[model samples]
Target: MIDLARQQLAHDADPLVVKVGTRCLTLPDGTLDECQVESIAEQLVRIGAGTTRRVVLVSSGAVGAGIGLLKLPERPTDLPSLQAAAAVGQCHLMESYNRAFQEHGLLAAQVLLTADDINDRRRYLNFRNAIRALFEYGAIPIVNENDTVRTAELSRTVGDNDQLAAMVTNALRAPLLVILTDVDGLYDGDPADESSQVIGMVEAIDESTTGFAVVGTHKSGPVLSKGGMLSKLQAASIATHAGESVILANGRSPNILVDLMAGEPLGTLIPGQGGRLAERKRWIGSAAMPIGALTLDAGAVEAVAERGKSLLPIGIKAITGIFDKGDLVSLIDEAGVEIARGLTNYDSSDLGKIMGQPSEAIADILGRAPYSVAVHRNDLALVRDAEGS
Candidate 1:
């Protein structure tokens, strides 16, 4: 069945995202391997040149490379030190990429980005346009997290290049995202167990898939970088939910990229959401983090999910957490299941007074004029289920 799906999804014309992990690019001694870099460069050039195919390479290895350059004993713990390492290593890393691409008569463009690029609508569009333009110029983009200055700007977790690549795949609407990693693919259980088998095709990365797969990984302390099987799974979930496929394969294997393009099925193939959500909705449902949550009555739940209506004050049973107007909030049901997420029109305090009231009553309760609805239909998007997929 996985084979049949692979054959059906063999879209050579669809743009591909090739994310090279630190493990693939670093040596056993915790240094950047020139051989691996050269090998990757050759593979990328082979994929991009002599065809109209466009490839986005989300490469990870900056920090590891930095450690070797600075002769550090282990990974740095301080944010400032990590940024310094990123600044130093990013230069040498790109230089290696440039030289390697040149050998195959191709050009490699370095694109440094932060989570803000994806969170901000305008900036995200600009980044998307730049990638498209790179394709027109017949150049492959080497994307990496802007680790140097992102700490202060992004409040969420740090160093998840796997998730970044997934976002890039969604932004480009690429049919496939190949996460080149150290492992062969996702196994049914622990790889060391003989009973565990590599699951072939994943239609949806829901609880079943995630439960069966490992979420965190570390071996012999830190080797090259922080990306593990769990990070890849998170990335796969994001991309697959956004209507994209993901391939997790062993980067150490020769011609892996070529084989995948040929539909050889060398990795675990995770299928995308059956249909594409509007780009704006994908951004809203994903990209931005929810600052707060709103609990809704059964009526409000029906209105939002079944009738495709905006959330109103009368339907909201309670408001939890602090949130301001124009901020994103999760709309949950009485059972505490998240049905949807959306940008709220009123702050939590304001909504608290307006809860269980009619739209016209909002103005009288809040003193100031209020938006007609608590959450406009245009600003709302459905969550997959109670787990908030």
Candidate 2:
């Protein structure tokens, strides 16, 4: 088992985010299984009942839950049709949650979110505050993506609910993230490999760890959700960076949540980086999707990744995509490998003109920039990749 002495593990984890994927939440018929929902609900209520502790459930099954009820032949391919399903199913989803929680003397509060709601600072705070208040009032907030209005662009922009759960975990500065999926945890090799073994713990989840997992597309996904093992690791990176523990376990075993609270390591424990990021910094790092790219020279790569320096205009060699001054952008090497991500001080148009130019030349090119730097060190977050898979 992983050590949790620093996290006050002897007692209940104060704040926990439990995420359940669509596969385990439904049966083969693609309908919302009340037994599964109630079992998970009972587990959550038991955790919430612990003194000074609160629980949040990030459920992803609205569209899939609606399919069987609406008698759809299969998952909808078009955006509008999928949104229609989510609209109908979200009601039933909440009703299931409310009824289940009520049985255990708990209230389930529905909180729907979109990308815009999370990216905007004021809106993000409002969402966070609302959920915090719910916990204080002895209510469990059931969160989900507002799929009713999202199009294809939103899928790439907002990512799936797995990433959304990571955002919520950071927004609340929760110490634990439990992502309940069909499998037990990350495996060393293919699940089919008889010799494969589940990796008991991970210090850092990075690109190499992700290389082994299978990603599920809409058609390839089992029933209703877009998230696969790939999305779970992506979410793990975000939560772990914020200095919170993450567990990827089997949702079919509802007792896993209770077991975790009782100090048992029943899943793959992804340890958090020791440096716990501030709330706003965690938000900036995980909330916004990159709108553009900046290819860094070798010197800049070493400086940012090793020396932790600001991205000066001189180190940038290329710029791709169109992004505004304050938009989040990818910082990559010339070979197109991502090194870091941050909010840019210069717009894409301005960056193009200033690439390979000296810092003093910024004033001559764009008349003047918010600052001489392309990306300030304070606004940056390095991407950690595990050594040798």
Candidate 3:
């Protein structure tokens, strides 16, 4: 048996973000399973009842639940159809959550977000404030992508709710992210292949195993099922890198949420980097989507990764794509591996002229210097290995 008390204490001492996937919350027949939803809700309420630690739920199933309610045979293939289903399903989904939480004497608030919402500066802060208010008011905020009005450019974009949950965890400055999926945890290979084994822990998320394929249930497709195990791994990497621990566990078992909060060793635990990033940097690192790429020399890579220095023009080897000043861009090594992401103070056109120049030379070349470094250290997030360390 898992040590429930210890685990719960650990989770309580740390910031915890719980993400419930569609497969776990839905039945085998691709229908919203009320029993499981109620069970999970009860467990969450129990966990949050007396704890000072905040709990935010990033849930999937707006479309799946909608499908069940609309009696659709399969998930829609087109954008409009999917959006329509999501529109109808989001209401039913929230209703189910509200009803379930009420049974536990809790009130649940609905928060719908698009990728663009967090990707923008003003909107991100607004969304964060709204969620914080909900928590302060003693309500559990159930978040999902706003698919109804989201365009392909904005809405159909986030890899999955798993990724969104990670972003939310970072945005909220949570200490831990608990991802409850249908599978037991991450495995070295396919779990049903008879020879695959669950990887008990991950220290770093690297390239060799980063793209593991995610198998899906009848209700979801391999890629569409909340980004599969691979996306969850990526999400874990993001969260853990920002100094937050993550857990990927099976949600099918009875009382699993309660068990996890109780501190039971029921799933794979991804340890976090020891110290937390400052709040502003955390948002820039996790929420800012890179609009372009900046290829760097070996020295620049070392400076940023090891010495924690700002990215200077002297280190830039080449530039790719067009990004405006203040846009988020990726810093890549010579091998085209992304080392980190940061907001640039110069536009692509300006960077092209100032590449490989000293900070002092910026004013000379452009007639006026904006700031010294192209990407400041305070605006960067280093990419972790395939297994989150």
Candidate 4:
């Protein structure tokens, strides 16, 4: 049984996002380690089984798994070659997950997303709704960044699964974000040197530990298997500020997920602010990529941040970049600080006409009111201070 305080903390926690790293899923030789993957899946099944808790897995190792299956010498550096490996590996990765989950009588659903999928408001809503439906059906959603289609040039790059998991946690409003890697947890110094100690229970991630070694081998001077420990910290910071907790642990440990859920001391824990973001508001704040930004006057900023009111067009003193209706955009104050992010119902063109206009005059100015609130409260996510900076 979990401690009452811990249980309440977990229950009232933000959404949980678990990112499975390549090193955790693959052997040192870069092969799919079925035993390890299966073990991790079983643990997850135990945590989500017969509970209201929802789990969103952000996984890597498609390329590595594929390379092993295809007998490739190493991870390809070229985009086309990398895409080819991802194409083959994504299938194998899903198959392994499906087989493992079946042993626990759980079904796994593959949900591949690219940066573009989350950048477009329509697609973002569609993706979110689909994943929600999958959970409702008692199936585990296996999420991966769509590597086969993603390009370096894409405007909406998640960069690594760590960042992706953070975004997913925000999207699902998960109470926790678990990052399972090869290492035990974040360390105070280089654990490889045997002089370092594991840093447990981080209230916040900060510069004191920013230079710690991430758990992975690099071909080119610490390129990081994908996003590395730095990225994980960055993601954790985002999730925690959104009122979600985060944990970084080793996936190889037996019953890891179950133990963590039960508040066992197994890894580093980053606590969350004990509050929940409203559903629609969470979606607006987290979903989609911000294509543009709205600069507000000081008064407007105060009203939105302190008064908890919807953003009106009158507050918008200036706009930057071109954006379509329903696009995710950033709300910046006079200092160019991102106060919030949300889905805009009106396009930049429409907004230009309505800027400084009253909400009541929206219909008269545009022939019809797209929405009463320029950026509805439900569609906004307030920014918090950076964690582990």
Candidate 5:
């Protein structure tokens, strides 16, 4: 069935973010597949043809290409060796993309970014401006993580191409984000079983949806990709919660991009929220990493998560990690699940003294009542509800 959301995206999605996994562009031997790269370039061009819509491509396979180029027996495990492979493979990957896009009379602009780049507000906006400039120049922006400098940034726990692509989609306010992988969207059962079928659309990401993410992976073994379906789903959750759509589809299929944009129901379609989040809130919820965490009592959790109230010291029961004033910290419920994140008004040391104390007792505990609230409602962003964790 054709969803109205997909149709709307086909007609109105101005700048699209498409993420292609490493496994889709590499062989079992970890070599760069030129033919696949060319096909991807061609499909990207076709998606923009006869329209003003532009595309930003998030591509993987640097380490794989490096392994093939250096003739390594297997994928590297150490940080130095992985970085070395990335340094070599980034050049080869760009060369292939440049040549492939040139065939269609389009310029491919390579943009390498690091986690710190996306984490800082100033650097993040600068990255967005650079992409906009490339659009004006009529060039397609091909983005990848700067693995050569900080391969740790690509670790699944910290972040990956999938998370990077979602961040780009939010930063650009792109209406759609299409994640292309090896498997055929998300499945109801094990993908290896013939009886399992692809789920057509997902309105919201919940525990049930996340349960499906544990089916492991297809096509890409551990040597090729560290990100599995869970990472992709988490990425999708990030985008969708920000009022942007996501399509998880198989890149190996012929003309997959073309078919998906045409509202052909090619993959699992996760629809967007009703309204977009404010820029500052978006950053707090998705971009910024927390330095510390505060565990709130049940009453505090209800007040903050359900009533849109500020976090008070009276509700805070436990604190973890060392952080200072204005630093980002996570708010955890009694169950240890993160309910929200925001900038704290006081440093960890100050907070430790006043936790569980009423607002009136702040001055007595800290010697100065500069502020009453632990986290202002204006600064806090509710995450658990949107992510449905």
Candidate 6:
């Protein structure tokens, strides 16, 4: 179904977040494509020329560019090799973007981020302020993961550009997140098959919607990157859950950004699901990476999920991983589904001692109870609702 209202929401959205994948930024041989970069930069400049809407571009191609420069047979699998490639290619990547945007009479600001940037609350706010300042100066902010420093291949926090883009969208509260990839859109069947049809609109991203991602799993993206349709869908889920719309379309398509702004149904649209979350809650749900998990009992699950109660020590049945006090932790139900995430009052060792014990028993068990509750309701962010769970 084509809904003009939703399309209008995307069309009129200020501060649009656009994510361009490696396939769009790199040639088939994994070389950085300067012409493609220019074309994309031109389109962005055209879209932001007259409108007050601020455009932020999240790009992926450093490793691919390195591969081409090094004339590697394929993408490197080792962490050291990947890091070395990123270091070598990051300079080239920024140079291309700067050259491309400068031709359109615009300056491009390079922002490299890692998981620590999002995990730390102060740094997260700092990043937001920096982006705002860049917009004020009439410069386009181009963001990418700090692959040279981050071991994303080993542990995924700023996993890929897709996830990084989603986090940025949530952090900025951008109304629309446009993801540009190689595919036309999410298909109902195998993308390579002629019978597969591109879905026009998605109201929400659920298990059924994500199922479409696996339909054509065999035909993944080029060897330049590890991201695929599933990653894009995960990105969509993040943005949509934060009350932001997403448009996944092919970047190679002609006049795609301009046409999208004109309210043409050119891509698969996943509209925002509910009201936008507050800044703190958005950070908790979308940005904070859980260092540990607390498994809740049946009663605790019902109380937290339905009654909106805080997580008490008595509710916790098990704890996994070593984490310190004030660290972000996941709250999972009996079925191992994550219900919420919040800052914990006690460390993993202390929580282990106080598990299934009442608030009165914490002081007795741990010498002193710093906080009565394990995780206060104010600090907790529910990822799934009761019905959804």
Candidates sorted by TM-score, best first: 6, 5, 2, 3, 1, 4
RMSD of each: 2.7, 2.9, 2.8, 4.2, 2.1, 1.9
* lDDT against the true structure, each candidate: 0.80, 0.81, 0.79, 0.78, 0.88, 0.87
Ranking by lDDT: 5, 6, 2, 1, 3, 4
Writing each residue's lDDT as its tens digit, candidate 3 over 135-240 gives 7887889999888877775422666789899889888888778899888787776767667666666766665446443542222342224357777888887788
Which pairs of residues collide in candidate 2? none
Candidate 3 vs 4: which has more lDDT:
3
lDDT of 4 by residue, 231-314 (tens): 778777677777788889988877787777787766788787547566566555654568899988887888887777779999
Q: How close is every model to the real structure, measured as TM-score?
A: 0.90, 0.91, 0.90, 0.81, 0.94, 0.96
lDDT of 5 by residue, 147-211 (tens): 88875643223388999899888889898999999888999878988998999888899889988
**Better candidate number, 3 or 6, judged by TM-score:** 6
Off by over 4 Å in 1: 1-4, 152-159, 215-218, 221-223, 317-323, 334-337, 368-370, 385-389
Question: lDDT tens digits, residues 143-165, model 1?
Answer: 99998887854454324889898
Of candidates 4 and 1, the better by TM-score: 1
State residue 22's C-alpha deviation in candidate 6, in Å. 0.3
Better structure of 3 and 4 per TM-score: 3
* CA shift of 136, model 6, Å: 1.0
| Model 3: per-residue Cα lDDT at residue 40 | 82
Q: Which 10 residues in a row give candidate 3 its minimum summed lDDT?
A: 215-224
